[model samples]
Target chain A: MGEFPTVTDVARVAGVSRQTVSNVMNTPGIVKADTRARVEAAISALGYRPHASARRLRTRRSSTIGIRLDPMIDGISGSVLDRFLHALTEQADARGLRVLLFTATSPEDEISQFRRLNDGADVDGFVLTSTTADDPRTEWLLEQGIAFVTFGRPWRSDDFTAPRHPWVDVDGYSGLHAATRAQQDAGATRIAYIGWPSPSGTGDDRRRGWHDAMLERGDVSAEDLACLEVVTADGVDQGAAAMQQLARTAGGIDAVLCASDALALGAMIANPARVPVTGYDNTPIAAAIGLSSVDQPVDEVAAAALELLAGEFEGKSGAPSDPAPPPFRMVTPRLITRQFAAIPRDSVPVNALVSEVSR
Target chain B: MGEFPTVTDVARVAGVSRQTVSNVMNTPGIVKADTRARVEAAISALGYRPHASARRLRTRRSSTIGIRLDPMIDGISGSVLDRFLHALTEQADARGLRVLLFTATSPEDEISQFRRLNDGADVDGFVLTSTTADDPRTEWLLEQGIAFVTFGRPWRSDDFTAPRHPWVDVDGYSGLHAATRAQQDAGATRIAYIGWPSPSGTGDDRRRGWHDAMLERGDVSAEDLACLEVVTADGVDQGAAAMQQLARTAGGIDAVLCASDALALGAMIANPARVPVTGYDNTPIAAAIGLSSVDQPVDEVAAAALELLAGEFEGKSGAPSDPAPPPFRMVTPRLITRQFAAIPRDSVPVNALVSEVSR
Candidate 1:
């Protein structure tokens, strides 16, 4: 193997001391312009690159962000994470940071990886996704005094005024609320909702959006509301079954809103009433099928996560940190309305009512 | 921040010299069993982890694999890369290797990233994906004498008996051939194919599979072959348009096979004749919509790539290597047959002809 060019070689070629070369590479602003240019030219000519590990050892920072690549399960919804990861990688690259990917089978396994990475000082911080209520990962990271940010809120309590760590999450409730109101504005008298079973933080939040919208109408009684809402497991087939049950129980359904695109698709397929349906996550399939869906601003979420991490690292760099509120961003999602095309509308009676609604 | 435990602290706790501690960490087999256990216990108690950067510098090897995370376009087909990444991460982790992701806008940009990563010795090797004919990235890596494996063939020539570098690619020709034969077995007298425009190595290779199968049938004339083949850009809408064009130009397309699920879905939606359709890539949407498609064994591709890289690295470590042929694995893809359900079959006459054939 050929030997790689060293800093000494670059310094000799540039007619400068080794320290000047180091200054040119690490703190170019501190070096004279002419000397820095000369050093850079020599570096380019010799194809010299400073060892990342050696530099990291000196700075006590890896300039790398770590994230877990969860196993691919639901390809429909899993594309959300894929998009976010791409955005994060692009944003991190712009900020001179790299993303290191690791895999863990369980939360416990993830924590062990965190410890291993933390002990080695292999990464500056971590960006976590797929947060659940009272997430053990967050708790462990906080206790370890690790610098990290999550793409989801802690969901520990109803009051989201403060969190123990930094986080950024999309507002599912607001998204569904907008979807329901849009359906109401479209001259739909009866709108049914299909969602995941209770105890899910995200699902419950979205369901409340539809519930509140229905209550504001003042025409539907509590008994009617109960009849209009269907809670089932999150899947395409489960969604189809829920729609069937809703059609049998809830009279004359004019519209349906789902917690996810998977369920929304199922509802569209099984819709005998041919109601206009809205889904969450605005997935590729939703776009292909022309389903009106809620779109999470994943790029904004990634940017916010990085911003919080930057603030944390800046505070650790001996800056005079303010007694600020725990950092958090509740990004409102946008409703992407497309022409409903899952079923042929000419054969259904409700099509006349929904046709005039601007999509 | 609290001070992290160092080799000195571990050595003191284990009642050993710093050199002994280092030896224990680096080469446990060289240390006495009792001494190794004592050092390990001390490390566990102190929560000491050997510095990854320091170890890397000593060994001149970073146990990290670099890959460019291309921007997410065509979410339907893009899921293939997502799945491959997850599988690679899992397999690399099992081998004590890390996967580092970077974004590149073009081949030139990707090559620059390779240089940057290589200069720092930050990654041991790279795994290239999304190969095109005469890919400059592979050329640059080869010129630099870097250890790398590609998840795609070089595609520089028609004769793929040997290549410049180790690679593992799915056999697109076989996949399409099997898909065509499956349709024939299902009583499809006239089968049509929809694929991307030519000059795309992967696309053309897949097209050939269908072409060879039809040619072997002896029943399809050259003029009929031209009529049955539709070439266009890859998109759902494009697929739909292609299928329409086929229905107009080609008579009675009893079954259709697409180069991608996105195209197959389009053909299915636009099929007024209600023919069974198959897509490639066996994406989650295919399963959701019950579109039979070809499935790539990404897990196997990842394993093969890593195994090739290991062989390359082993050859570099003063081991006598065999004069073996350049490593390559043309993995055969599986034709996943699912019940076609994009359109209802009760009204279509073609359904009667296809119903007797097993799925």
Candidate 2:
């Protein structure tokens, strides 16, 4: 036949009804083994491929996940999302699911997209990224009883034990704490912290890591700790400027810990020979320049997000209706330390040694 | 009323047949204006959503584009695809299309995925990346008469004027040519060219740019031009090694031009103060380290690929059956010039100046 084969064609070829043909394709367990075998043979012989949309409409389930593809803001840190997306796609594909991408300008637009995709039955669930404080997207999703898992914590409250929705986040506090401790172990007495301004959940969490690490040292007084901390906007230039100021006022900073690779890079640029700097996110720039940084296990985060979405929290406490704490995974990060003769300034020397430790 | 509103419910509410309701939803242009308006109102009042799969099955168009999400191999150059995917998602969204992502182990697996998506009526077309010589994917797509566009040229032939399929690619030759000219104009007479090994389409094209630029200068002999060039596998370490070998063997290298930012960065790291280098792709590393490089206009490429897939080549002299050179777009890249006191090799001091120019 010149026309494409349809369900009816498969039914006639298999000597079965149209519903039987569909049942063989969608709900094979409901059909008898002999009849299913005949239908399968007919489907293969005639190359009768069932339309995904038609099957989805009948079953009211599309093996597809929806996600909002954010614009590339900065290649440095923006690469985290890129890596996460790649990992998510691979994981979803392994589960025989497709990842559908849409673009939205804002949280409201994203929620609207969710409604469109959910209403159209185009997606079974969603994976959200870049979670912010009191994220309206999560609020809307929770209100709608939609299935979704974020790659970041809800950040609605400081208590990580409780959240309204499932989430997977990198433990920034642990990452920075380890970085600070690593520097301290390397014999750095006065280490300076450069990070984004307060009222930011991620930045503050990372800053606290450095703060607690210094406090545990017992040698640096609380006043000295306060002086060692420098707040600035996140950027290489801002990091450089912060390092410069801290060096002048903090009385010779032996090491520097940053909230982001951009800031760490700046600090390294400002004083290549004076201090060993560690940055967060372990971006490519850090590896290229031989700067130590905290590496977020995004692949683990992706896997955990998929598990949460798959409702793999059966062994955990609380029922579906109970006010139980939603399942969330906090993946520990690894600190990558590189000891080079100097930070990449106008080339002066050589010798590079790299090491990694998970916290 | 408690259950989802289907065609039967919508038809009953609107006082129309089920087919009429479908026509209103799927082919509104064919329905009477008054009847279509009435059905739409009933749909809105009842919150009746026409299932996307049902409509797709009826119309045989899903308005979806399939793209394979490559695993993130290296954050540096891999970011180009990341940026392209983001732009493509945004551009496709602006046209009321969705992007579906899948992962495959190899080209054969990718083709099977294409068949699955195409036969299942889950996608209208595809957007392929990483085009290679005699790509079997393109061959299969051509044989299947699929509507798809590649982001790179069909390298089956060097004469880009005639390709079996439509494509959008950056003019790497022009990008390197402009970069070479820029370095020469900056008063650098003895420039060294660093690139990947030959038999590679993109690498060869870029090398020709530098080669032709040197030939045009009329000062460097053919023998000297050959001596000035060094080829190696693409990487930062490889680049540094190549640069060192070139510097020692070629004698007194004033400037360096690399096929990629990774190589350029490597060269800069090896000789921070000795050579000013330019790299291709203008990765974030280039900016962080203050290295000059060429920037691909990926946004334009995304738009052009979508246009080609949408059949925007109506003005071109090619009938459906005619072999009148399937339309293609070769976008010219821009050169970003960044001058700093030194590379980040245990930095001593810096005075940075950044500028950009289109070629």
Q: Which candidate ranks first by lDDT, i.e. highest?
A: 1
Give the per-residue lDDT of model 2 (tens digit) for A84-118: 88889999899888999999999999999998887
**Deviating ranges (above 4 Å) for candidate 1:** A1-49, A319-322, A344-359, B1-50, B319-322, B342-359
Per-residue lDDT of B139-164 in model 2, one digit per residue for the tens? 88777667789998887755475787
Query: Candidate 1, residues A1-359: lDDT per residue as tens digits?
Result: 11345789889999999999977654555788678778867866665656665456556678889999978878887778888999999999999899999999999899999988876677888999988887889888866556799998888764376577888999999898888888888887688899988888889899999889888876577788888889988788777888889878888688999999989878877775567888899888787767778999899998999999998787654432346656889899999877554563222122221122110
**Model 2 stretches with alpha carbons more than 4 Å out:** A1-7, A10-49, A312-324, A341-359, B1-49, B312-324, B344-359
RMSD of 2: 10.4
Give the 10-residue window scoring lowest on summed lDDT in candidate 1 chain A: A350-359
Where is the poorest 10-residue window by lDDT in model 1 chain B? Answer: B350-359
